[model samples]
Target: MSARYWALIIFIGSIWGTSFLFNAVLIRELGPITVAAGRVTIAALVSWLLFFALRKPLPRDPMLYLKLGLLGVFSYAVPFTLFPISQAHIPSGLAAIINALLPVVTVLVSHYWPGGEKIKRHKAAGVVAGFTGAALLASPSLAAGNEHGELWAIAVCFAAVMLYAITLNVARSFKAIEPTTIATIAISGAALTSVPVALWVEGVPHIERIETWAAWIAIGVFCTALAFQLMYRLLPRVGTTNFASNTFVTPVVAVLLGVSLLGESIRPIHLLGMGVVFLGLLLIDGRILKIWRKPVSGTEVVSPR
Candidate 1:
């Protein structure tokens, strides 16, 4: 990748990492449902504004909306709500740590799904190592006997990652649609899904704090809306394999922000688990190994496709 692409990926990763920090702030005054609802709502609005500004043509197919609606519910509403609920029990850093498993899990899903991507030896090993790290991260909470409901929260976060993996696989079926349109419609569907649920359950949020409002807007605009735009821009040029590098950057940024800004403590186990997960991600990425494989007898080493 060029310097410009690298810069863009890192910037997107940093912005995405701050989402957990913003969620922590919003959850102080907002219920999980309200937080989720507000986030998708703002993101949807901003996305539609961009959609119009870009002068993109709308899809006339009704079935497309149906598919996008399902994407919204799975990709945004449920997982978005679940994260806040989990963050209530666990630190934002821990949430991000578990959420980092998306790429690994997606690899696993792709291997099994019909006509999906096949796993190579490195990716298979990556799947094992990734789940092993997940187990390590969860061991402390599980051994603590769920006294603080951290175990359940950890499970919920894992569930969210699984949903994300599945959504990613499903989204691949939308090859004919523009990425921005898919994002816009999906976010709009999430807004439509969550707002009613929030109103019904949370009974309308009343926020007076300036910081809370700022945090909400930050998450919606930067984390959700802008992040999607960046991903769509980079995906075509870099391909999914390179784009997956963002996963590694997110957890590190989340942990740093969680510790420094949110005043959360990180355990040694968290660091160890994160390191193991990074190892697995590196294996899947194959970049370091590619560098290590030197040419022999003047024959160039070629990467596996």
Candidate 2:
């Protein structure tokens, strides 16, 4: 990867990593539905503005619009709402760590889908190790006797991750569509879906502090809108397999922010679980194992998609 791609990876990772912190702060003042709705609405507006600025035409096909709308519901609205609700019961770091299971989940889901990658021995091992790590991470909450409801929160986070994996497959299926167009339509659909839910569940939200408003804007602009744009741009150059490394970086940043900014405690078990999960991710990616194999000619590897 070039320096610019490297910079994009770091920038996107950092912005997305901080998204958990932003959600934590926003959920303090607003309901999870409200926060999720506001962020998507803001992101849609920003994305549309960029679409116009770039002179890109919106998709005219009704079927495409319908697909994007469904993507919005599954990919954006549902997962966005779930994450914040989960964060209410769990620390942001734990929530972020759970997100690291995306690749494992994706691998498992892909196994059943037609034209998907077959699960090899290494990937099977990765799946087992990854789930073990997840179990280890959630064991403490399970041992808490359901009083704090951390297990439920962990389950919700896993659901969100599953949605993310599904969305990745959905996005990959639309190879003919431009990323920006998909982003704009999906975000708009998410905004449309979330607004009514927010109003029904939380009513209209009031902003009292400038900091809260700033954090809200940051999430929409930097984390959602700009991050999507960067990913779309970088995907062609780096390929999805290389780009997927951002997953490794994002959780680390989230953990750090949770520890330093939010003052959340991290037990030794959490560290061990994170290490195991990362090792599983590395195995699934086939990079470390490739060290003993013959070198390939191309810069790109075929992604599971």
Predicted structure with the largest TM-score when compared to the true one: 1
Instruction: For residues 193-238, write the lDDT of model 2, one tens digit per residue.
Output: 9999899988989889787899899999988999988888888899
Model 1 agreement with the true structure over 206-276: per-residue lDDT tens digits: 99899999999999999999999779778999998888888888888998999999899878998888888
What is candidate 2's TM-score against the reference? 0.93
Residue 49, candidate 1: Cα error in Å is 0.8
Name the runs in model 1 displaced over 4 angstroms.
295-305
Lowest lDDT block of 10, candidate 2: 291-300
Residue-level error in angstroms, candidate 1, position 147: 1.5
Q: List the residue pairs that clash in candidate 2.
A: none
Write down the TM-score for model 1.
Answer: 0.95
Residue 213 C-alpha lDDT in model 1: 97
Candidate 2 C-alpha error for residue 280, in Å: 0.9
Model 1, global lDDT: 0.90
Clashes per candidate, residues 3 or more apart or on different chains: 0, 0
